[model samples]
Target chain A: MGELLRPEEWTALRLSLLVATTATAASLVPGIAVAYLLARGRFWGKALLDTLVHLPLILPPVVTGYLLLIWLGRRGPVGSFLADQFGIVLSFRWTGAALACAIMGFPLLVRAIRLSIEAVDGKLEEAAGTLGASRAWVFAAVTLPLILPGIIAGMILSFAKAMGEFGATITFVSNIPGETQTLPSAIYTFTQVPGGEAGAMRLTIVSVLVSMAALVASELLARGIARRLAA
Target chain B: MKEGLTVDLDHRQGSFRLQAAFDAPPGVTALFGRSGSGKTTLANIVAGLVRPDRGRVSVGGTLLIDTNSGVALPRHRRRIGYVFQEARLFPHLSVRQNLLFGRWFAPRAEAGAEFGSILDLLGLGQLLARRPAGLSGGEKQRVAIGRALLAKPRLLLMDEPLASLDEARKAEILPFLERLRDDTRVPIVYVSHSLPEVVRLADTVVVLDEGRVTAAGAAGEILSRLDLFALSGPREAGAVLAARVLRHDPAFGLTTLGTPAGEIHVPQTTVAVGSTLRVQVHARDVMVSLTRPDRVSALNILAGTVAEIGNTLAGESSLTVRLDCSGAPLLARLTRKSVAELGLSVGMPIFAVVKSVAFETSHRPPAVREG
Candidate 1:
């Protein structure tokens, strides 16, 4: 398997895994908070915020990538401020690929978690309150545990989406061969050049296998949480 | 200790308005009302779960809510335990964990209550490791009660804790509640619409009708009022009496209670001598006899004068007979025909005969007895 793929193909595979894992892990906390807010909060401008979170799913990936590039690219307003203030550069870096994937996968993550949070019985939270638990403790002990299955599902969905991401990764980070080339981008690169069919096929099979593995892991995690909660 | 709970509340949910006030001093204060009568809403106000638009609530001396001073404490901070209609035990935690969940938040200074004793009191020793899903309705309520007590709350609010149970299950839980009321110092505000439950459990009755406090006083006096039955509804109308186990007759297997009315013989109680029992006599179960009939099997007979008479919308008849014995008020419901046959009128002397089986002895201990 190692001999079948070139060094650059292997590097892209390794980089893609790193980027997707980083993206999923980094966005988990904020994803849960946003999901909870959407599911439970009643406030002005909530619909607008929800629509904004869902924009990436409906807008063309290239358009989202362009927006990211303009807003988060170095020398752009937010990008220049971040670069100067925090020495962070998200243009043409592997981190840029992670940022693109996180933004693109966020809607799916929030949606799964939001549905689970909404499904939780509010009466249970009130009971927790009466049991002397503050609102924060109630969320930590009751709401979080009850919605854990959804969180796992959301993380897996985001990871799978990140692994297959192509348009946003390429448009935002320019698909550098060894730096920012994710699996789909690498496969796209292999298909574009002459006599690259074998590499493209190999990367495509790897993508399918990775997605299947994530789906199975998600199911197992969900089942384990359900059993623990039931017991 | 001067144990008391006072709540004067006024609130509105959309178009529905709730304006109620009642004072319950210790014991089991039963908030009696029909469904949607704001019984639960009032309990929630005490628990600090629902903030009243205007009024003050204090349990034992701690002010939980005082809208005038803008001192409305949050539910957790108030240290008032609430048992919901459905036992909302945390699904993720084991039974023991759910019971101790509140302990983690209770102030360390107030955490002297022993968990072992609480579990023993509620008969929940064997259920420590099991999750709530594995428990029966009765067991769940016991665990809920234990959880609330372990929090060392100054007040406990139970909103129809047995409303979800069947008859057998309710019977299963009532004994534990009796034990809790007897053993614990925690003041409880019990909410229910079941007449038997109010009779068996409550020492103070706060009757609410359509979000207003219709009657509130000693359970014996307030529940026996015929006016409350007309105002609150028929199903929840009954009288509660404080009685002591006078003697246990082995031959008839009956326990004679020394109540205000007379020596009432009830089905044998397992309680010891000198222990007080709360007995509920439903208005419908009481009969008015013009004279003490001979060859009667009924053991409880008290001579009383007719206090009041009223009828429900369904044409069902009810009569409140205030007995001269011990100055206690006893309610006897007679048919409209019986009312005429006995020629019962206010100040007319009559015999109120209650069957031995009709008196339900609620076994709550005297320590938590509300005046």
Candidate 2:
């Protein structure tokens, strides 16, 4: 394992882990909120909101990256406002790569979480309300604990998707050596060069193992939560 | 006048419109109605789970909802506990934890009831460590009741708490509820469509028909009124009586109860002497006689004044007679031919003869309370 992973490959693998972890953690709260709204909220424009959330999954990765560039670029409205007010920048930096990865993985995360939230019984929430819990307390106590498995699954899915993201990250943030080149981008670079097959294969194996571990962990977590909630 | 509950509500969902009004005192007030008659909806409005389109609800002088003033407290702040038809216990929590969920959310100043006593009262001590999934239907409802009681609610709303249980499970939970009503000072607003359940539990009956309040009075008087039953449906018509156990005959294995009019003998009850028992007498179970026949096997024979006479339906031979036995009201269904032959009319005296075997004991004494 040590010999197959060249210095650049090792750096790519570490960077991929850091970027994926950061993206997944940052998107978790909003992902859950959006997913719950899609699953349960009853409003006039609910269907429209649902379609908008799923737009990323249907569009080509490069197209989504270009849209992100226009919207979150340095001179874009949100980007300039955030940069000026909070000194936060997300253009052509490692943070920009993380943002691209998060956007790319968001649809999958929300889909999984929304399905789980839909499965939770709304009657239980009403029961909680009648038991003297405020709406916020009911959500925190009953709804959150009941849908924990979905939240964990959503996180793992986002992490896996972020780890493998390539087209969007390269287009939006550019493939910088120690900054934005994630595992998939680094593997693409290695395959394009001569005598880089062995390194590419090693990184490929690493990606497969990481994804498999995440799936198994999610299965176990979902099962544990299911057993706890089995009535 | 003692402060009680007064509700006048109007709500519309889609095309369904519900408008109802009633008043109940400090006792077990039953909101009795059939399915789709807005019973659960009314209960939800009382618990603050549903906001009525227009209404005014006040319990013991505390305004809960007033559309005119735009004052509506949320469910949690209403301090009214609700027990749903299905026991909605927290599946992830143990029985003990589920019971404590409401207590954790309740303000510390309002938690006056002792936890140990509640456990003992519900007979849930042995199941404390078990998860909700491991419990039987009866046990789940008991835990639900304990959870609501621990929250220190001023008024409890039970929406057919026994509706999901089988006969045996219903039997298991009925006694616990009786104990809850008798022991706690908190008034209960129980919602049920079952006549037997309302007869056994309620002190005041609020009969609803198609989202309208049809009858509201003491349980015995309301249950005996055949007109209310005819308006609501005959399947739910029955009479409820309040009686005290007079004596237990060891030799014959019979217990005699002293009701308002006379003594009633039945198979020996497990309850001791002097305990009040609510007995339900189905209108169909009664037979009338103008003269007292000798050597009859029927155990309950009481003289009563004919209160009212009403025909069942067109071309039906039977008539429903409302009888006033001393102060208690009883109902007897007799043939119209017999009623005419006997010259029965309002204020005429007659005998209501009931067979002892037909009287089914509605509830056992609360398991935790011994007379």
Model 1 lDDT tens row, B3-122: 599888889988778898877898889998888889988888888778788999888988888999999889888888888888989989999999999899998887446998998887
CA deviation > 4 Å runs, candidate 2: A1-4, A42-51, A70-89, B231-237, B363-371
Worst 10 residues of 1 chain B by lDDT: B362-371
Candidate 1 wrongly placed segments (more than 4 Å): A1-4, B1-3, B231-238, B285-292, B309-322, B336-338, B363-371
Task: Write candidate 1's Cα lDDT for A1-231 as tens digits.
Answer: 348667887898899899999999998999999999999899999999999999999999999999989999986899999999999999999999999999999999999999999999999998898878899999999999999999999999899989988888899899788888888988888899999998899888888888898899899989998888877
TM-score of 2: 0.94
Candidate 1 chain A, poorest ten consecutive residues by summed lDDT = A1-10
**Candidate 1 colliding pairs:** none
- What's the DockQ for every one of the candidates? 0.79, 0.65
Model 2, residue B346: distance off in Å is 2.5
